[model samples]
Target: MAESTTQRTAGSAPKVQLSCEMCRQRKVKCDKLSPCTNCQRLGAVCIPVERARLPRGRFRKSKAAHRVPESDSADATDELKGRMERLEGLICTLMQDNGAAANTIVPAMADAGILPSPCNTESRSDLPWPVGNDVRDGGGLVAQKPSAYLGNSFWEGLMHVQNRPLRNLTDQRHDGATFAPYDILVHGLTGRALLSPLCSTTEPWATPQLQQHLCHVFLSQVDPVFKILHQPSLRAFLIEGKPYLHYDAHRPAPEALRCAVYYTAACSITEDQWPPAIGASRASIIARYQRETEAALVRAEFVTSDDLTVLQAFVLSLIGARSQDRSRRAWTMLSMAVRVAQALSLHVPDPPFLITAFEQEMRRRLWGAIGLLDVQASLDRASEPMILRSWLELHAPLNVSDDDIPFGHEIVPAESDSFTDSTFTLMISKAQCAVRSLTEPGSQYMHIRQACVADFQQTASQLLRNCQPDAVPFHWYTLQVADYIAASMQLIALRPLQRTPDFTPPHVSGSNLLRLSVDILQKTETLHSDPRGHPWRWFEGIFVPWHALAVAIAELCGCEDAALIERYWDTVEGAFERFGGLVADEKEGMLWKPMERLMGRARAKRDTLRVVFTPESASAQSQSPFLPVMTPDQNQHQRGMGLAITPCSSTSGSIGVEPWANVPTVWDEVDFGDVGIDQLSWTNYQDFMEDMQR
Candidate 1:
């Protein structure tokens, strides 16, 4: 019987042993030992198991959940592609048509069966949210429709300007057409001849070579102060004709942006510095590019366009305009730029959409530039700043080089401690906070001045020391701008003291107010007269230091020190010599008359001080303290003569001497500690007031 049982057991399947619960759960092999190999390897406790397992067979069927069909998704994608292709085709067709007005034809075709219709309620289900209402129309990309078009008197107003016939665009000509000036047009209808005498087939106004030169000029001279455009990316685009394809990419900067760069470059340089190969006068080039820039902004519908690049272009145009002169037209344009920036939500530090690191840094830089410009424009108009008081969360851009920001998805590098292209702009950004305090109701000047000094003085020194040799001129310009900012803030702060009934003038020996005023005037003269700073002198018109000049003349009228008066007078005369003709024709040109009268009063003060301090005043004047002045060698190799004295001037006394030689060049530690004004002692206070009234 035992032999028969053994034979049956052998014939049947061998006995199966169960694995431990740990190994069973892990689906790993296990020996029948107490601590299995899998559990020992994992350092887990092996629980002995004797649970029954389900019988192996075909698995039970489970109910399926609802999902979108692949076919439907494919169809939608295909439909979207078809719509895009059709849109491109329509654009090409319109471009080919000679007489077709894009404004009139786009809506007509959209109404007909030719183009894809606007996404309405029924079609909204197929389109994505937020982008469903966004479509290209005649007046550029239409703004998103408000959830409710609320209006006064319970009347529903139009939410979008799309397909609407507006009478005038901001930069449009008197005529209703958005057309480029004849000077900016290069090719002919037949493509065989040029339309304008200045236009050339190889290198016209907007040719790549001219653009390259101007762009280099801008990058070297003006961009360091602003630092908005990415240097490497822009240079690459100029060379390879492909911009960085990423969020908010300009794609070879649109016409408005391109022309803005050109206009600004022309404004920065003098006529002599203009490329001789281009064969165009600087004035003519500036006028043509300026008109074309305005026309391009009109065509882009800058007021309503949502493209960040369009806003950038408009801001740049306004910057150039304000640089040339702070006219009411420029202020009006600045208001438009403010509105556009607000519409783009640039005030918000963090946006709802995903953006690359490079784009984030760029947006911050742009906002910084916009805010700074707005404050400056306000200062020029004597109005409150538009953005400094706002609840903006945007921060200053990092002081990093353009190359530090990666184009790919790699992590962004840390901001550098050394000076970079963005250092000056970052300084401006931080200093603007102090500028905001100047306009507040009960703000303290000392606190603000100290804040600026503590924030910028050391950094400015470090940056100047760290700057590249080739970029010294731009850094010097930045240093001068810093000095001007501090002096101007003090000027703004002290103006009210002049009006107060309890005003007190500083001691006759020396006044920080006078010193600061002289500092401002000296910087202004340097910005306009220095050959190194010629490429950035466009700012001279906007920041003319009229207030500082007035204050310096007033303080000099009460001065007792002959040398101090002479030195201060030298600064005033230098300013007049450099900027007299430019500001003479400006709207504030009437200021020159009172300023000249004040100059006369200051000369009288100088005569009195000379009588008191030293005899033989007339002979001593020739042998002045700052004398033994060296006139520039007439035969020396000279660079472009940009607002500098003519080399062949017959009046040979200190003819070619730098105006700022006696003035303090380093702007590191300016003492704005005791800035005040003297109402009773200021001889031409009434004259200053009269000129202001005029």
Candidate 2:
């Protein structure tokens, strides 16, 4: 028994040591096990160190006078000076190189007509707010105030003037106050003018039952995409009528956010799903909720407010507004929200001592949402993205559900690898980063364009892998949307290639670009037509793929392959028939007239081709899953009209199946420049389209 006990004691010895010797030298926390994390990261062999016995005495304070020798301090100072000198020299060398490069590039750009000449003499208007090096008076103002206006989407004065010594609007103001007469009216005296006269309470549209339903819808459908609000906290606040850390009477951020949620939910509700007890049509409900949201925004003083909740409300309201109207007004409002986010420093993470991990994650999510919205707005109008890549240091939020984050706790749960509440938001952030280069002027270069495509594909594949095949409806829908976004961004990145003269075999490039466009259009068509996509149709309706439709129609006008031509026409006309309402619309002004012309050309091409498909082949083609389904009457009408209805024998993927190098050149008869495609090069397609309309 004594021998057995001795053997058991020897076998029960602890496996862990004090720490690896390297970690001990570096003074980093480490797991005491062999091959510690720090050693592994540094690729060093971990040497285990046993714990040393310490003397049972207090730590002694070192004498300040004897801490260092005078000669050693002098040596340290000399080394520091040498390092500073080297840094200064390197900075000067870089500046000189950059200046020389700019000097060489600018004149070349001017010669190439890429930059405006000095003698162009175009009047450039400055902002109403003062911006200069000397706005201070003789009295010498103590400090400069920050301007609320950050600038247009293309650039911001704040970013420009941050490093420079400059006086802002504060120097001109009487008491260094940033508020103007308009701000006084909007923020102080005229609150009643904008107050909701429809309902006496804060949310008249939100009865308890209705609020529950809307909250459910928003949480399930919209929250997955936005991921701005914390579900548990939001629900608690709603139930208890309590305010968060930044909430106040003057800044009604929570109320505004609530109204915004109600508006978004109402907008997202399908006609069949509308509550009968509301005693109003879904349209009327959306309008009333929208008005309430606007009133709430005014009450919250959103323009001057730097509250996170206010920004969330503003973003949500803009999203709801997009469903109602695809106008520049929403884009302008979105830019204002971007400015507010910048003011709040949402582009950077907060220190651990300053905020809880939960709040930090929330802020990251809000910034991600803003970037996603900016990307959407840019795509909608073909304008420069509001949130530039240079300004963002924010990372995507963790892929965990709200339940994983405990309220008022320091613990941060591990992020899930599979689909979660934040998966869609993370995907959007990735997509935004992928396409950000598209807004840069340098993206016209072949290397940058190719890099953009490569980066986007890599990110997209990673995202798709994270999503499960048989996940929930929204997750599956997000997958399809990912495919759509991938196609759209690739099209944008490759669009500049068509204008380049050095690209060999223009026909192949044109064909590849056309296939990308077709893929985008088909994706759009599928999202709108599918029954599962009905919940997300509000968003789908807003982002109509106008550029893709144009490309497809342009290709079809010259395409000789009967089957491919018909497939192209089927995609184009399906888009047109569904979104034809926009053709007559003056609000969300797209280039419908140019589209009409392209369709005409396609019809003319159809008239020239003989319709010679046998009934048996037609039946087989009709049974093909790739082809668009049409009713008997519709087919008869199209046949009578001599439309190009040929059977497709080729069985390949619907989305750009042919290899890039092997795509036959069919762009011989296409004249994109004549149809205002050239004008789309430097400006928003809609802006050019509007000019053409005028």
Candidate 3:
């Protein structure tokens, strides 16, 4: 017993190791592997103890068994994504709120358009953001400013404005080149307007016939495509006086909306477009209507009153000038509307209790139109779309003509067929909103793969197939024209990336791209304001991209395949003829002038293209007087695309010169001209490179 006790004492020593079950059972020497050598030798079943599986009387960690439910995991992931998107949007708002004074790192960063959809979004987290919607906390900016917040989206946006300049603070040129677009973009976002002297008008706003003419001009001419100002109700207000034309302490008849209509109509043509009863020079009439509108805005407090009519009036006024080179002002004008729209929660879907479905529909129309304006105003930019889809729960306006939906028509009791019929119209608007992300020509928003591109193409085709041009020519054509432009731009994007829209790792076939380009050009037919008469309107939309067309055509004209060139040759000539038609619209005044000037440049470019893209061109190019200009490095980082070589007007620089200087403008050098490397055709690419070598 004394000997056994001594052995137990020795066994209980500090260095004692646990024995394997097989060894312990066999009472033999064993190593601590799962199957001890002794078990293998005995050919017995060996069960090794696992400390991890062993039950502990004490000192075990209190972790619950981790069998995560699929639903729970999915919910967590979705919640996290929602938080991230919200945080991103908040940061974007703060960037705008912080303004030039706060983000001294790059003060003049362009607030290039971003925003939310059809009235209101049920899910704010899913909303796509436009880069420009900076109208300071829902237009209460007059009362307060956006608080500063920092994040990837905000700083990334600021850091990546197309052709933005960055340099040592010590550099003199940096201030001029880098911040030029920034100053312009943020100018209107600041709470207070500088208050300009109100210009006066001479048009007869009280004249019933004149109001009739102007309203007709908007609906017949503009509304089919734009659809901003509600047509049926607006018409009823004029003809039947149903909605009560309410205005504040001003010349009762000369309210903001009326002035806007007058201005837009007057600007739409020279004095000849109107009858003798509405006699006024186009220039003088434009001045008068503009004056009345501005004066009314100054006195008519839309913000304090929270009247959407005033906001609508204000938007209409801006729309009158939408065709102008107001890229800078566009940022402010639309952003102001956005703030008010948000203040009214127009981006959120309305409950039937809060607003009738009709009202909700109208609000959605206004918001969607505003979102489009916000994008177009940014000079046809795809990055930082102003409105997000998630922020709006507003459905698309019914596809039915205005005649179908009377004033205050309720949706709940409506025929389901009418609602179902309007699917195409809704689809078109979705495409328009998606343009900001879809038309991205650079790597800035490339995560959007080919599937999105395919959907856009399919939708465009479907819209075209279902549209009745005779029923609503302007509206139908508007959708048609926009789709064609998107197709053209997509073709451009597909070219340089070589692979499909999905960014698959392969080069796109040049021939498929060529065929697509020719097809887009063929669809780009010109239409006049009157089908067979005077007052010719260019087939222009906010998204009507003349430059992209020009680039695509230039590439096509230079194609190596003789058969393809001959096939699409007339299409190219036709595009030019149509573009040249704008010059005849000299009577349209300043609104048409920017495009007119672009056409003039296109004419010059045409001479170059004829030589470069046609069969009889190589020798001509050798003798060409217009030499290509080259930058030391043709790039600056536009956000996620870090220092990529942008061939669009050479967005790069050398020493002492402002790194961002001489970057083209919408009115000047190039308007939103980043079409990716795809815009550069192989021939043009080679030629441009050769020039660089020279």
Candidate 4:
């Protein structure tokens, strides 16, 4: 029965052994599955007892059936449930701790490119870290813990904890909160490509966004061409789109053009790499010339004589430089002297004698530089016959006739040949020479005086014979000739009075001279008094002739007849006062003051005469050299030879007035012999002669 029972027991028992749950948890082997299938069905771990030495003759029962009693089963089950619950809670706490540690390690790992995008499981838990076991113990679960961070978790943890403060520090460092979003986007994109794993995905070919960004960067780098062209207008148009197309066209504004030219010239001097030797040499030469010229002007201020040869030489040098290649740089420097001369002529502060000489010098330099023949070309281009006539009237006294004078070259026959026009060319050239000579000192005055007389006679004869009495245009020309005649007569009168006071009078009578003087005075009064007269119509044209007449009449007042002299004086005073008022009306500020001074001088002279002499004060007049008509022997010769009975000389005292005293006058008082009329005329004649010789 025992044997049968053993067989049943062995047949009923399970064949395979099972491990205890503790040894199996640790992966060790076990003898049997104590409480294995049954415990498993009950949701309990199977545990086996250790093998023990058996007592002699005693049978051992499996301790597995000695499980808790039925009454204590509930208690044991409760206790097992509590222990399992506690163990599970401990494992969860450990898992939470491990996940937090991983979170700290992952960022640096990703930065180093050692961790994958989504980290593997082994990478998460391999702390102290086995290769591919990246899980750290302190922080939260992190998928991609960088290999770099895993090397030092303590440092990584501090860095992770310090993120907000570091961010604050970065914001303070860059002051980046003030930056615009576009700026931030640009910086962030750039940094990500430099620092992140995404760099590997970046394409070599330019994308649309990349192209746009590159273009913006390139445009920011270069200066705008239009901005360079219109520098002054840059600020006004910078923000305007399509500035080049929409802005005003660059027509150089006058101020901008002037400034540009000046600046360009200045920059050329400054920036050009001129040879040091040449630049220094040129600068020194310029400085010396300036110093010398200034010194010359200073010397000229105190000089009493009218010789302008030094100044002329300086001016000629300047003009000669103009046609030369090297002299371009001297143009501005030369203009300075020319301007000074122009100013001096316009404002004549020098004595009349000196002023006359300076004006002649100015004309000489101006005409000489522009070739002599060019003056004729200028006159030939005149559009109006009246203009030609007026020009001749003002200038012809200094000119001579073509037949009497030598012209350097004759006009070719192929061109239009008018005798009058050819005569006009000769006239202009002669006039220019005459003006030049007049300005130079130590020039002979006799020939100029004679040429002036001859010119006056020729002009007067032509007008009186050819001009119709009613021809208004021709009248002014006749009047100008008459003025020249009067001026010539006055000069002739002054010559004998100055050098040879005791000389016998000429055959010409003072009465005839008086008649000529009265005629001119009456004509001038009639022409000026009538506003419709040609002289009044073209006032500027008549100013020079009128002034000459005034001077001539003033000299004429020194005649023999008291009544006529008084009449001449009154006439001049009235004419000058009227002219002075007209000058004021014209607002010709430059001429008005000089005209005023002349009028004032005339007034003072007239007032002095009124207070000194009565209406019948002729007898009180002194016996002067002008009183003797002819010496006794000269009178007898005229009577005996059946010669024409010469009229009483101005020296004769025939009208019961002593010869008019030849008072030292303005004309003779100033010794312009160094710069006189005759000398000027001879110089001009010589120049003409030289040109003929050439």
Using TM-score as the measure, which candidate wins?
Answer: 2
Off by over 4 Å in 4: 1-440, 455-536, 539-542, 545-562, 581-605, 608-694
Model 1 ranges with Cα > 4 A deviation = 1-204, 244-253, 389-394, 408-412, 444-454, 458-472, 483-512, 560-564, 581-694
* Weakest lDDT window of 10 consecutive positions for candidate 1: 189-198
lDDT per residue (tens digit) for residues 1-694 in model 1: 6445323422253444577777765666778687777788888888875432321332211101223434556766765565555344433333222223443545675667565444332432332111122332211233332222222211211122123333332234223456653223311211112111112234355555676787777777667776778777666654455544443433323655666777777678766777788766777767666765665565566767888777877777777766665346676667667887878777877777777787788778888888888777655544577885443334668888887885553465687866677877876776676667655655544455345444544454554445442345565556556656655655655543123333322222234456666667655665667676676766556555667777777877876667567655777667655555454235354456666777777778777887666544444545432222223651121221111222122221221222222232212223344334344445355456455546
The order of the candidates by TM-score, greatest first, is 2, 1, 3, 4
TM-score of each: 0.59, 0.60, 0.50, 0.26
Q: Local distance difference test, per candidate?
A: 0.56, 0.58, 0.46, 0.32
Q: Look at candidate 1 and tell me the lDDT of residue 334.
A: 72
Per-residue lDDT tens digits for candidate 2, residues 1-694, read 6445333432253443676678766768979767887888899999987632321222212223224534456766765554444333322222232444434435565566544444441221111222223221110111222223322311333334334333332233324345554334532322222322313222335456667777788876677666888887776655555555445533467777887888898888878878788756788767767766776676677888867788888889887877776456677667788888878878766533476777777778888878877877776655668787755535667778888885655666798866677777777777777777765765655456657756765655655455542435575567667767766665565453123333211123223444556657666766766666677776677666776676666666656655555545666677766655532243246456556665776788766663753355445555343333345644532221212112121212222222121111223223433443433222332333344345
The clash count for each model shown is: 0, 0, 42, 32
**Clash count, predicted structure 3:** 42
- Model 3 per-residue lDDT at 59: 20
Candidate 4 has its poorest 10 consecutive residues by lDDT at 192-201
